[model samples]
Target chain A: MTHLLEAKFKITYPEFSLDVDLNLPAKGVTVVFGPSGSGKSTLLRCLSGLERAPSGFLKLDDQVWQDEGIFIPIHQRKIGSVFQESRLFPHLNIQGNLLYGYQRTPLVERNLHLDEVVQVLGLGSLLKRYPEKLSGGERQRVAIGRALLTSPNLLLMDEPLASLDMQRKAEIIPFIKKIKDEFETPIIYVTHSMNEVLQLVETMVILNSGKVVNWGPVEEVFSDVQLRDAVGDGQLGAVLETTVSEHDDKFGLTRLDFMGQVLSVPKQNIPMGKKLRVHIHSKDVSLATAAPVGATSVLNILKAKVGKIGAIDPNGYSVDIELDAGRPILATITRKSLSNLNLQIGQPIFAHIKAIKMVHEMDT
Target chain B: MDIPSIDSGPIWLSLQLAGVTVGLLLVFATPVAWWLAHTRSRFRVVVEAVVALPLVLPPTVLGFYLLILLGPNGWVGGPVQALTGSVLSFSFTGLVFASMLYSLPFVVQPLHSAFESVGKIPMETAQSLGASRLDAFFTVISPLARRGYLTAIVLGFAHTLGEFGVVLMVGGNIPGKTKVISIEIYDRVEVMEYAQAHILSAGLLLFSFFVLVMVYTVNRRLPVQVT
Candidate 1:
């Protein structure tokens, strides 16, 4: 079932004001992608009814959380929020911490079993430990489990991975993905990291300075040059789901079937049938009018057709490419590259997607 | 130890004064400290300053003002007398009232800071988890702010136990009725009975010191740190 969460709210602070109207998809991971202080987290807070909007409306799964005179307190809203800082109660043991939210939901409203959450978060051994005894990653996992055990209608995550190391972040992505795909409840995931947005979500809401700059499907929004400007260098966009085919050792390459073509990347040891997450920052990419026969680069090039070119800023530009041999890749190049390649709208080109430059983060 | 007066036994009178003052201050100050720690009201600093006034004011100054208030023909004194058919001035009950005011901030400021340091996050998170405000206060804030309570109770008790000027002004050192330890020692000294004064003074010193040391040492063990 397609779900919808609509909100239009305004909050005023000492020197800043956040006024935004957001419409997020009901299922899968809908990412709120934006720059810092763009009211991304504030939007999440408004959705959960944590910060009441003086004059606004919010609806989640046909339930009105807040609209004019109608206001539902946070506990009554059934929206679970995971703050960036793991705000676990220090006095409670790990089991007590988890049960803190579990016991809150009415007996009639509880859905998932207690043992299942402990298993999912690998918390069976940590039940007796205090909050301070656990590491940062452990605390976050408990936080996730605590929210899940609450059986909320929706989960709101405000950059939960921002405080974690890369390895710990990778450890949690599969769990987040499982919640996104296996569960019916929709998730509003907020992040300033494009890699995170690309790795977990299918829908996107691009925000800038407390306003909705763009919102649409993940692929379409990432390709938008204006939105590309919203997400800066090295974090630019190209996302393709590729399945492992075989490792070509003679050429030191691993071949994958992506979209409609057989593409190759550096000798990745991923087993057969496993999928890989490919994120190519627009800046690290180069476009060519002809597929060069002899290139020193060993892997990760696709034959794509140029769709449209647009000016993202005064000095930079973005190009949309459809990789006929594989999945589509969105490449943002400079105005100079476009002119030098003599590329125009509707021109066919070879995208030199670099092997080492592309980022690969695994998910179950 | 045997002193005859219109009042009853010395030990009974001292107990009444200590009990009344400790109970009254603890009751009034808990809520006041909670509010001082929580409210973002613009007048909080002013209220803080006023609450702290008794701490620095000369004991006699505080006592003089309270004496006038509780004295017959004075505003509070007349109302209290008319309602209860008894005057508070120069009585054991009056000494407790005077001592409570003198020790108000000692019990309050530490508790307030303790509550403030406990923060709103844990309480708020607990409330969102469906714990009521009262439940959160007891289960979360109280456990985290345990040291504040220890500090407040000990300081309040010790401060009142050692009160001198205020007791002299309001309590009037009536033997067997209004003479708390500090005043007992003071009275002995005034009559040039140095040996008696030294004994009582040493006893008080040992008692308050032991109480404070035990409180602080035990409180140090439960220091709160969030993960």
Candidate 2:
């Protein structure tokens, strides 16, 4: 349960320089979220042993991949990676691509079986199709399957869904979660989308301008007022992990427990006891000066307190409010709402959020 | 004018020679082109210089050096003869060797550029999936660089068909053995058979056009993204 993934490096090229100090988990997914050109992909390259860091150590599960005097070549490192583009071999059919990695990993200590992988990835029907023959999402699924069959101790995915449309992105997320659920293999997922970060990862490493801005649990990291530098102004929000309380067939609603508030949304297929994380955008939330009865506008009412107010944008100011029960929430209202409700730092308020505003679907 | 009249024997022999030369060149050129694509060697310029030497050097000059290397007195010939139990001098084997070297530039340039245009992510992704170096080359790099390989094959075959000074020096135009179409055409013209020479030359011209058309057609079919 305890393992350390540490790296410190300074890379100087003609056009760019990357200098970073990173400490991430040796288990679960540590999402590297940042803006473009922030060196997120470059950082993963150092971990994969594809890029040499003259003076650093990359050790995962007792094996030192690179150190002061020794550098394990990329071929020797037991790391698997997926790029923005699904780099499946065009010459090979889906089965061939999957087997390409399976054959490379030795029989001893193989964590996954070929059949299980095909089933989990839903790739059984695709085994005969060529890489070019599959759609964008199906190709990415094959790419993920190909990487997982290798039984890598560490997985690095650089914007795995960047090229896909929103619908296609929604398609591959559950497959990724299946890997996380089944294996203890640490995954380093690089992405810029806040929705992806909230839905996909529990731990986060926020990177900006070739530096580690913050690193912690996904919930705490996003709730941090300083995280504005990591996630852009428009994207700042709190990440909350909640369970499916019940599904109301009568109302076609799924009730989720968020900060002791039984928030209800349109019914989804997610069965009971399924854990899901969702990002409630700050702008979608409305705070009231006093609790009221017989209001049809808001689907959720949670007792909260003003945590901290961030910089003001053109129209309104965004406030970090902690749900009195648990979890932090973001609510943006005009400066008029702040004074009208006498909303100040540490003031008690009721946050009203609508369930239909969920940006993405959650899975069990 | 009293020499053996050029016939299908020489034409077939030349075709066989060019065919074998191109086939061998392709097999060897694949790895070389791949290396040129992926290797970060400081001496890549040096290797590139050597490969391009055949392009710049006069065919007779290259053929003369090759003759000396494969001839009895040269170092390569002795070891080669020792290994094969026969001399390579002035034979079909010698002609193939000369043609491969003579036509190498044609194959290398096209394949090299093809591999370059293929970019590196696909190959790296394959290797990261635990594929061994060679496996990645064939499974990932080759498929991605296919256009380059085709370019290499067509250019190599056509270039071998067009060899002049090199074949004259190394192959020596033996009618039933080493003589190819170009050498056959040369022999016909030397003997004042303009009609036969014109027919063979026209065939060569048509062959070049056919191969060039194949290259252009395949390139257009490739997924070339225009900016």
Candidate 3:
């Protein structure tokens, strides 16, 4: 049987309010993406039972956590939550912190073992030290490990990397990915960083001004022109899931295959057949009416058909055009270029891809 | 100069009163301090001012009110007299009750600040990790606030040990019942026993200084020190 998570919440404060209704598959990582003050944290808190919405309904699979006149306390919700700060108990050593939740979870319900978690988070050496003794990255890893040890049915992370510097964030992303891959617990991660959304999100929920603007598969949502403001102008792009098909060691380039088309990027150390997420910014793509006959410096040129065209910027100068190569891709072009090329819906075209970034390497 | 022998009676009584007062105050003041630290109710400021009244009010003023309230025909004393067939005023129980009121702010304020410094995040994190509210308080908050507990215990004990005015008004200098060290010293001075008075006064001065030193030393250490 397929597992599903359903949630509906309406919470009001004096200045801000949060209203959302979401039914998402209880699998992988569902990222709640928004800018600051967009109620991302509030929504996560409601789901975790930390904040009680006066009117809300929530259920994970067959278990109902909250409904009309029925509210479960936070401790009874069986959720593991990690906040922006690594809220490790200062009094407890790393080993003790990790075991805190594990010990509280009933013996019959425990599934994730302490040793395996310690190994995955690379926490073996630091187990004897207290939270104050560890570096920021180490402390966050312990916090994540502490949450995971509870064997929760769902995990909620509210900007777990927000407090760390870029170097520390880079240090911890892999462990987060490992947890996503190894654990069966569905995760609801809240983040304001588009980079985090690209690197970790499988499903994306876009929150704007205390409301959910859009929610769907990450690739489709990223391609939506309506998300231009929420995701920032520079971040409007397409996410393509591709597999490593060939390695050209001589040219220091790697080839990825997606939908019978090949995209080459700077060489990656990942072995062949590994799946990767390639992020293509809309600004990097240019359109041509006919296939270029002569040699071009751009390595990737794919034949696609224009699917939709609409103005994304408020001034109507720049337009975001959706192109259907096999999977949908988005390109941002100026009005001068659109009229110069006379681009229209259903027009067959050639897309010149100037750059591509390999965002995440999926574990097969 | 020859050293005068100190009477052990008042010293033992003072120790016992301070011990019992500290013990009882810890239990009663903890919940009040926790509530003050975390509550958003408008009554918080009102309650805080009320708890702090003893700190600012004269001891005799508080004692006079306690004297009236705990006397034979007064509200508390009347109810107690009917139920237990004993008077509350001028008794050991009355002195203990007065000391608890007198030293309440010392115990509650340190604990309030400590609980405030510990903040809401750790408690929420603990609850999210499957610990109940009570369990989290014992496991996470208590350990984090140990310094505050230490300070509260020492201050409450020392403050109760030095009580004189409130005990005098309520307990009326009853020997072996409510005549604690401070009153004994006063009695010695009254009878021109300067040498004996000097001994008890000097002992109290040294003990208070030591307690203050311990509290300040702990507070000066790095807050996250292990244990």
Candidate 4:
């Protein structure tokens, strides 16, 4: 049986209101992606039972957490949450903070063990240190470990990386990825950063103005034109699922196979057959009428067909185009180029890929 | 310079009264302080004003009201006299009760500020970690608010130790029953016993100074302010 997390919430304040009805897969990472003030955090709070909506219904795989008459308080609902701030107990040392939830959970119910979590989060050395003594990254790692040790049925992260500087974010993202890989808990991650969304999302929910604008598989949602508009200009991109096929050690490059086509990226340590998700920004992809013959610096050249063309920008400088390269790939090009090339829907064309970022690697 | 021989009875009585009052006030005022820190109820302002009334109101005014209320035929004292058959006024118990009222804000304010500084995030984080409300309070909120508890205890105890007017109004200088250190000093001075009065007054002044110094030292050494 396919377990599902079903939620329906209607919350209103004088200034803003959130009305979302979501039926999400109860596995992997489901990223709630939106801009700030899109009610992302509020939605996560509702799921965790931290914010109670007057009339709401929620159920996780047939276990009802909240309904018209049945309401489980936050503690009763088996969930773990990591906030933007570490929120570690200042008085308790790292070990105490890690064991707090683990200790409270009934012995029979506890599945995640202390030693395993300590090793996973690399918190062995910090056990005796108080929160005030740890660096920001270390503190956030402990916070994640503390939450995970509860063996929650669902994990919620509300912009865990938002407070961190770039270096600190780099330090913590690997641990978050490791947790996702090692644990069986389904995660609902809320983030406004498209970078985080691309790196972590298995399924995506796009929220805007207190409602779900769209929700689907990562690729489909990224391909949605509405997402392009919501994400604004520079962040528009397509997510492609690919597999490592060959390594050119001589050229310091690795080749990936996506939908029967090959693309090369900067050398990766991942072995052959390992699946990876790569993000290609629309601005990085350019169009050509015919395949270039001579040594062009662009490594990826796929023969494709233009699938759809977006409206000209208000500034009237550029337009967003979608191409069918076995998978939907997006490109932003100048309107002058579009008219210059006489581009038409379903017209055969060549898509030059300038850059591809390796977002996430699937477990082998 | 001669050291005057002092009667230690009033000192012991005062110490006992302060101890009992501080202990009882901690138990009773914790919930009040927590409520004041976190409650969004409209009555919060009213409750806050009531708790702080002792801070601004003259102790004799409070004592006169307490005297009327806890006197033999008064509202609280009448019921107590009938049930327990002991008068509340002019008793050690009456002194404790009055001191608790007199020193309430001293205890509640520090605790309230501490609870406020601890804030809702840690509590919510604890609850999300599967700790029950009561469990979170004990493990997270109480520990985080320890400094507040320290300041409250010292302030409450010291304030009760130095109280004069409330005890005089309700307990009426009954030796070994209601007469505390401050009242003993008053009696000594009234009887022209300058040396004994000087001893107790200087002792209280030094004690108050030390308590303030301790609170300030601890606060400075361990800064737990989150924002």
Candidate 5:
């Protein structure tokens, strides 16, 4: 159950060098997050043997893919990679592209079936189409199916959604969540979007200037203010991992059970008992001194205590608050509101969540 | 009403030369063009210049060099003559060899550009999918470069069909054995046999015009892909 992927490698360009020793978990989605030109994709390329690090050692569980003396070729590694551009062969039909890897992989080693992959990625209708004819999201879904059909030991995705518009990104996120839940294959995903990192990742690796700035569970790394500051724009928010406890079709609301509190939001189509990751923007959370009146429009009310208070910026009057609500939740409020509420570390307060949106969900 | 009869032997021989030259060049130049398109080695410039020499060098200059190379006492010819008791000069095989050299650039340049346009992304994607290097090339890269192949084949065949100086210098006029259509037309006109020359020349004119038209039409239909 504890599959480990170890990478001790160093690669140098004329102006940049990436030297890192990482022991990444080889089961769930491990997101490699960083700014542009920070060696995030390059690290995945090294793992996939696309760019060989001269002095490197990589081992996935017991399979040693590369070392000082032994180096496996890219085709032999059985690692699937989905690049930003899809990279689907323009000449091949969708079926042909999907089968390109399936046919090459030995039958004895195949763990996924063609029909299962086709159904999972919803590629049944588009099987006869060419890559040029498909939309960006459709192309990516096909690419994912193609990679999954290879039965890869590990899948590498480098900014797979970076090219799509918001709607297209929404279209592809569910498939990714399904893959993480339904498949046993490990995924090393590269992304810079904090929203994506929160929505998808279980293990988070923060890379800055070709070095690992932080690496741990997603919740632990996200709650680190220093790391949050490193990833700027202050888009920091709380990602609550919850299970759908009930769905009230009459009131059009879904009740999510998290840390013994049931939070209500708009009704979701997901089946009851399914796990979901919900993102609550810090700005949307307002602190309350006592439980709000019964008729307030604010839907979510949870008891939490202030944990850490961040410094106020020079121009802006806002400050970030870390709450100890079983699972840590982040809230940003103006200094004026903070003083009026007289918030302090370890002080009990009520968090009135104005809105809660389900960012991603997984089948149990 | 007296028109001299035009011999078709030279016409058939010219067709044979063009066909053989195009076929051999397709096999020979593909690897060279692929290397020229993909390699970043220092020797690429030198090799490129050598392949392109036929484009600028006078046809007679190249033919003279080939004539020496295939002559009875020359380096390549002497060894062949010793082994087989025959010389390559004035032979159909010699003409094929001369045409290959004369049209090297015609076959290689287009193929090289085509290979370059195919780029490395698709091939890299194929490799990621577990295709071997050779398998990926045949399946992904070749189809994408189909237009390049068409251009190369047409240009190589047409250039070989129209060759005069190289064929004259290397193969000479040996009647049915080595006299191609161009040399035959020249010989007819030299003896003031304008009627014979006119008949032969007209057929060649029609044939060349038709080939060019077909090339333009086909290229327009499938428009040459740069990427």
Candidate 6:
């Protein structure tokens, strides 16, 4: 079955107008990524019915939420939105806040029990605490749980982790990943951080200047050189979907299998046989024309074919190389390295994997 | 000099008037205040100015208009009198009606500010959580605007308690019926009853100070405290 979440909106402000037409996957985490003032939040608001665009149409799966003359009110649309700020009800303790949505959702439509949501988000201990009393991470976890308890058909998170400190963000990312894995609901996550995009997105939409520059599976969209540059600021990177093949306890290393190649990294707590999405930044990778023998400091090495070569930096010192090593990965080498090696498309090469950082580990 | 015992009739009447007036203002002005706080409609300015008219218009001037409006042949009074066959002017209901207009802004402004401070963020969150606009207002907005309710209620009740010119113009100084505390004090002073007037005036002064002190203290204590 091909389930689709479709939306078309035309909203005109005094200074800016947002016009978007999208047919997004109805399941999995779809990311809307863009720079500031690109109308990412505005588009999310249009979907949520908070900002009504005069000309709009939205249909999720078999249901039509909005058409020419008919528009479903926000509450009737069965959507749960989490904003940058937790926006939790200050007066209500966590338990009360969580149940706020629970009580509103029709019993027939309610999918997850309150206890299940609490345990999933690890919010049991904080249930008696108020929003003001909880830490930023704790508040966001509760906010996510509160939204989940609503039994929404669609979940919209607009920079849910933006307000948190780095440590707090690390604390909440796994829970967000957990929701994607455990729940059947489709999630539309809006963010500007390339890290978050790589970590969470399955279907990625690149929004620029109120338009979608690209949209598709994260792997393909990110690997395409033209679309990768659309992310801006030269933060282009590649996302690889891999599985944990083994964890060497004694050696303190984890081995991940991607396509047919295995790469080893510092040991992760993730159990063996778990699937993961790892992002390798273009700048982080180094290449060699021929395979290097035995331990230099780099733990992993793989054979690759050069796909595309281009200068993606302002200073023109570094060149971005797209490689095919079972999966497309980006590597940025100095202009000097590119010239010295005489790199060209279709040329055979070796990607000296100096580092392999897990974007996020997911168990399947 | 020995102080004469104050008659409780006017004091009791004033308390009743203030209580009823505050109650009516909360029920009527709450929705109006919420609208004024959130609406982008062009009529918002005109509505706001009209609600605030009582604050700037002299009490006597407001009372004069109410007197005409609530009179048997006047706008409100005519319809109301025809329906119920009772004079709206010079009645307890008349005093309440007069006080409601006089203290309109006192209740509306505080609630307006409180609602504005709450902004649309929480309400939007609530709506997204499957709460209707009405449900969100009561569940999310009302709780957050508790401090506003306190300020509005205290100010409304207090303002009504000390009302004089409007009460006189509309209700007149009908002893034991429409004679509020302020009117009773005036009557005492007019009759050269200095000791009785002194007792009532001083009591009101102390009571008002206490009420204001309580309001300020509570306002300082709770960030969102409503009760």
lDDT of each: 0.77, 0.79, 0.89, 0.89, 0.86, 0.86
DockQ of 5: 0.49
Better of 1 and 3 by TM-score: 3
How would you encode candidate 5's per-residue C-alpha lDDT over A1-364 as one tens digit per residue? 5578999889999988898899977777899987788899889889988899999999999999999789999899989999898888777789998999999999999999889999989999999988888999999999999999999989999999999999999889888988888888888999998768867788888887788888888766765445444455455667778888998989998999999998988888888889888877777788987886678977788899998987775467888788878888878888999889898789998998887744566434
- Which runs of model 4 end up more than 4 angstroms from their true locations? A249-251, A289-297, A311-316, A336-343, A358-360, B1-5, B223-227
Residue A312's lDDT within candidate 4 is 77
Chain B TM for prediction 4: 0.96
Screening candidate 3 with a backbone cut-off below 3 angstroms (N, C-alpha, C), the clashing residue pairs are none
Better of 1 and 4 by TM-score: 4
The parts of candidate 3 lying over 4 Å away from their true place are A293-295, B1-3, B225-227
* Residues A142-202 of candidate 3: C-alpha lDDT, one tens digit per residue: 9899999999999999999999999999999888888888877888999987777777878
lDDT tens string, model 1, A120-146?
Answer: 677899999998988888999888888
Q: Candidate 2 docking: what grade?
A: acceptable
Which parts of model 2 have CA positions greater than 4 angstroms off? A1-4, A12-17, A242-278, A284-301, A306-326, A331-356, A359-364, B1-24, B35-98, B169-181, B193-227
Error of 2 at A307 (Å): 3.8
Query: Tens digits of per-residue lDDT for model 4 on A146-208?
Result: 999899899999999999998998888788788888888888998888777767778889898
lDDT of 5 at B9: 93
Chain B TM-score, candidate 2?
Answer: 0.91
Q: List candidate 5 segments past 4 Å from native.
A: A1-3, A243-274, A282-323, A331-359, B73-75, B78-85, B223-227
| TM-scores, each model vs. reference | 0.88, 0.79, 0.96, 0.94, 0.86, 0.89
| Native-referenced TM-scores of chain A, all candidate models | 0.88, 0.85, 0.94, 0.92, 0.83, 0.86
In model 6, which residue pairs have backbone atoms overlapping below 3 Å?
Answer: none
Scored against the true structure, residue B127 in model 4 reaches a CA lDDT of 97
